[model samples]
Target: MAYESSVPYRAGTEGYTSFRIPAVVRARSGHLLAFAEGRVSSAADSGTIDLVLKRSADAGRTWGPLQVVARNGTGTAGNPAPVVLDSGRVLLLQVRNAADATEDRIRRGHVPPADGRRIWLQHSDDDGASWSPPREITGQAKLPHWRWYATGPGHALQLRHGPYAGRLLVPANHSTPPTDPQDSGAEPRYNGGHALLSDDDGATWRIGYTDSDSDTDTGRSVAPNETTAAELPDGSVYLNARNEAAAAWQRVDAVSTDGGEHLVRPFRPQAGLSGPAVQGSALHLGDRGALLFSGPAHPSARALMTLRTSRDGGLTWRTAHTVGGLPAAYSDLVRLDRDTVGLLYETGDFSAYSTITFRRIPVEEPT
Candidate 1:
């Protein structure tokens, strides 16, 4: 199936040296909002970064001018996790850190609390036209022992069916302190997947389903990072995360039966799903009774953007459609309507960070 694509955010174009971490959502106003990290200096993870966005009023055909949703001056503000509430208000969760505070320093607990990674919340009442000032929610969303933290870097989920319906859930990841005092906490093994929940709309937040086991030697332990989630057909929540373990596959997964409060199944390598160690997105097709995943299909490198489908609630997956064969990285999925889906991703000829494109694909083409 052919796809209609457009470059919403191109590196070096919007006063940003690079644009990374693509996230998109359809607001209650029926407008598509595409977001990314506007890196001011370089494509590196650290430095002055702004949470930027663009809106497409006519599906994914075209995008509006760039808008800075949140900025921290010389500090870093990125990892956008956006969701539209039932009230038509759009809530966005993101993180911030000092300009010089790199992930290594933050993970190793070398930075002070003020300069360390912190979570923040922002809301848009006029769709993508304007946004409220960022309000810190780090204490409620982050654990004291967690050093490195990040929100979805993609679109978050909201429950539609069951008693927990209307609850806002955000898939997230964090790094715990090292078990061994002599060991540095910079190891990816210390990373784990988690979720943040808000019951009273986006007014308050709390941590949920933390997979921070201190023992890395245990075969059951998994280093799940950069997570994405979807609500299954049976009202359960399925989480698919980027596995950081060197010996395991690039993907790990779990399930939460009690809304987003706890995980019934802990993080484990998802068999048959092959890809590089990078972030991916998951979506549940309620009408079709199937689940969809989008990410790179290459086993060793971030390339070949592919879409997979699982009919049995994420137990297994099969290649459904290959979107493109280019250098691809992080991606997010949005349901445009009953027949079409939208994908916001990073892809380029030479590097994935060169452009963040939005692609419209037929829903039936992937199922």
Candidate 2:
């Protein structure tokens, strides 16, 4: 099969002025769900953004109309991180903030009650048809010191091995040192990443693991932000994170064996895989038992959307193909079948945020 593309979101349409942060997932019901941040005001990250979705029942040839699954009015309700249980139920984890609080205010520790950046969740028992109202889980999922926090801008995962086989892992990120004691006049940098574990199928949540500043000592800082995850055969959870530390923000990888509470080893940079400080995703292709990562490959730019494969469970990766030389940014990978995969991302000719799109890729090895 060839790679076919579709535009599901665009600037100035359907009451939304722009859209960004695309995430896709295939439910057990054999339906494709595409999600994006419907920025109702402008292309900026902050504003009245909602978690919007579209469903594709016929593989990838077509998609349903736009539906607002989660919204917070003028407030922020975005970064859709969805996971499908083995029971065919889809659970979504997302972040929310007050209408007046911008990213800057939250990262600086100037937070407000019931209005600060917090975590919320919703579930759809009927595939992608209807969603339950969002319920906050910030008390259990978020720490008191964490300010700028967000769930997977991509997708969550389901453990397939060990005692945590049925657990749901929500890849997430947050900034640390909620206070700037030194009075440094700079933007608050996201320090690391963590995973929220749901053992009872999205009922209760807890922090699995937190990436620390130990890796940042490598010449420059290394903040693991906007993470992606996959499970290995040995029951280890692998995280591919966006290093938003310096100009050359390379990607990093880590693994956890104990339900994401502790790391087997500190994060190591995936020097070969590169991209701008942006979100990406990872998917475990069944049958072949290989891992696939999707994101921009350019060092200083966010174009040249690249697809990579790892046979050894994320230890190393090789470029399988470049989706295109088009302007692309954030992307998420989803398995359509044993041999068919899908990529939902932001792509356009001039700007990456101009459109949120979808594409189907051949998942088998390239000859």
Residue-level lDDT of model 2, residues 204-245, one tens digit each, is 988988875534335645678889998887788889888877
Candidate 2: pairs in clash: 208-260, 208-261
Give the lDDT of residue 164 in candidate 1. 87
Taking every candidate in turn, the Cα RMSD to the unseen true structure, in Å, is: 1.5, 2.0
Candidate 1 ranges beyond 4 A from true positions: 184-188, 365-367
Off by over 4 Å in 2: 178-180, 184-186, 214-220
TM-score of 1: 0.97
Report the C-alpha displacement of residue 135, candidate 2, in angstroms.
0.9
